[model samples]
Target: MGTVISRFLDALRFWFAAIRDVLLPRGCAGCDKPDEVLCASCTRLFRHVYRKMLPGDVGRCYGCSWYQGAVRHAILDWKDHGDEECDRPFALVLADLALKILERQIPCDQARALSLVAAPSSVASMHRRGRWQTLPLTRLMARRLNDHGFSALARPVLKLEGVQGKSVQAAGAQSRSRRIEGHVHVTEDLRGDDSLFIVVDDIVTTGATMGQCISALRAAGARDVIGLALACTPNRDE
Candidate 1:
């Protein structure tokens, strides 16, 4: 009876949200362009490919936008504030980033099998948010990649253990690295796997978390690993 009641309440909430959306359409999450989830201009911001330096042989990671101003605001809305409406737009942008990375790095004909990995969120974070935020992005990316002639699968094979606090709460690169180090781990063996693993994340603040993810995959015997993020923080010189 309790489970049924909980599900009924969830359904009621969903319908209420739908009705509210129809009655009072919200402006763009990125910019206050009336009735848009993410305005065209802001969507374009997510189209630029920004490179971020990573640790070890991984060297670099790619993002769709520089995390600042409107992009940051929009992401926070979707990620922290439960703006689930932004999922579709964000997923499409991530898929576009995946294609961009593939085009620049390897020809489609020569590309290996692809695996889309959602960067792990801590258990506490998932509980707090009521979802694994990146999971939908990865799944949608896999679908889009498959539509474009790539054999891809969304694999949530990464896990974060013993992590405390949030990445946003961490101040500097060194602090961020320390927070994630020794905590990101692979849930399965990748020994002898030849697939190209792509880690999908919303933000690459310091590249430490991404580098650790790539390193963990390599340690688990993944031959090739790369990261694709929705946004990246700019370097001081940039």
Candidate 2:
């Protein structure tokens, strides 16, 4: 009887959401046209493109796409606001970048052994939103990687504290500097032997957040941690 009630409530909630979406339909996040969340044309225009990573670049993490214009607004809407429809297109971009990394850099065998660690959403934000958005995006990317012959699993590794401030434009260089100061904690029991772990996030700003998360993973004994993200802001100097 309890299970039945729970299931019925879940169905009712889903129906309510459907009706709300239809009644308060949103425009394309990019072009603001009244219809789809992200119009087809915007998806094509903002297709994911790969960027090269240089050797011995510790603080410099590899990411795809410039975080500006459509990409910037889209990510803010999804991450800060509850723009749920942004997940699909965002996941597609992340998957494309991961594929590029697998093809040109990470070997097929190594890629298969990799575990994806999604940067944790803030506690307050999660409580308010009722879901960890990054987890779904991570799962979507993992499925794509697995389909392409990579063994990938999304693992929750880090947890965030404090209220998320207004979105700031972070420079890649400043991201490195801010790393030495932030206090982040790892809440999960991670295997030290998981040598190939990809830290996944929706976007990388100054990379300070990713750096803090990677630092926690390394402290927890992860052998090799690679940072991956859907989009990145261009450096201030760029």
Candidate 3:
């Protein structure tokens, strides 16, 4: 029954996209280029990987692009402006980036599962958006990885709890840390799993949220937890 419903919803989404494209064509979500959802130029912006390490975390983090220019604009649309159309592209890009990161950072044991743990969404955000945005994106990334012969699963096991609204985007590192400090709660017992869990988020501004995710998951018994984001805000000094 769940599979059937999923298929039905997928079909509905497809038709809805087709209709939207035909009836209300718009310029590129990024850069306002004419007659494109996301232009090829904007897509090219994400080809490079921006890898970095956050403070007070055991795992390294990787991003597909610097969070600026077209990349930032496109992500904003997909994440905030109800532009669900960009989900597939973003997921595929992220999956590709993850594969590359896996190649460079971790050995492919084949026996171990690759878990994509999406960043937790707040109840208020979910209520306002009427969806768990990262859930589907993470699911798509898992599917993409599986298609490439990797055992991957999307797990929404992390929960953000007991915080005021809109707190993840605090200004500086200290502010960000204080806002989200101890608020990330792991919802399941994934501890001691023989899997490489990658915490995926849309953007990494101060590395605070990603660091917290790594700490929380590791504390919860996840043997390995790394951060993956669509874009990373470049260092301010640089």
Q: Which is the leading candidate under lDDT?
A: 1
Estimated TM-score per prediction? 0.91, 0.80, 0.87
What lDDT does candidate 3 reach at residue 109? 73
Candidate 2 per-residue lDDT, tens place, 1-238, comes to 9999999999998998889878988888877878777788767655655342322344556665677787677777887678888887777767777777767776556444767778776565577677887888888887887887778787776776553522344323454334333556677666656547788876676666777777788787787777887677666566
Q: Which ten residues in a row have the lowest lDDT in candidate 2?
A: 163-172
**Number of the top-ranking candidate, with TM-score as the measure:** 1
Report clashes for each candidate as comma-separated counts.
0, 1, 2
* Cα misplacement distance, residue 100 of candidate 3 (Å): 0.3
Better of 2 and 3 by TM-score: 3
Inter-residue clash pairs, candidate 1: none
- What are the C-alpha RMSDs, in order, of all predicted structures? 2.2, 3.8, 3.2
lDDT of each: 0.87, 0.70, 0.83
Q: Which stretches in model 2 have alpha-carbon errors above 4 Å?
A: 50-57, 161-182, 188-192
lDDT of 1 by residue, 1-238 (tens): 9999999999999999999989988989998799899999999999988889876667888999999999999998999889888988998999888888788875455356898999988887898889999999988888888888888999999999997646464456578678778999999899988889999989888788898898888899888888999999986679
Which residue segments of model 1 deviate by more than 4 Å?
1-10, 167-173
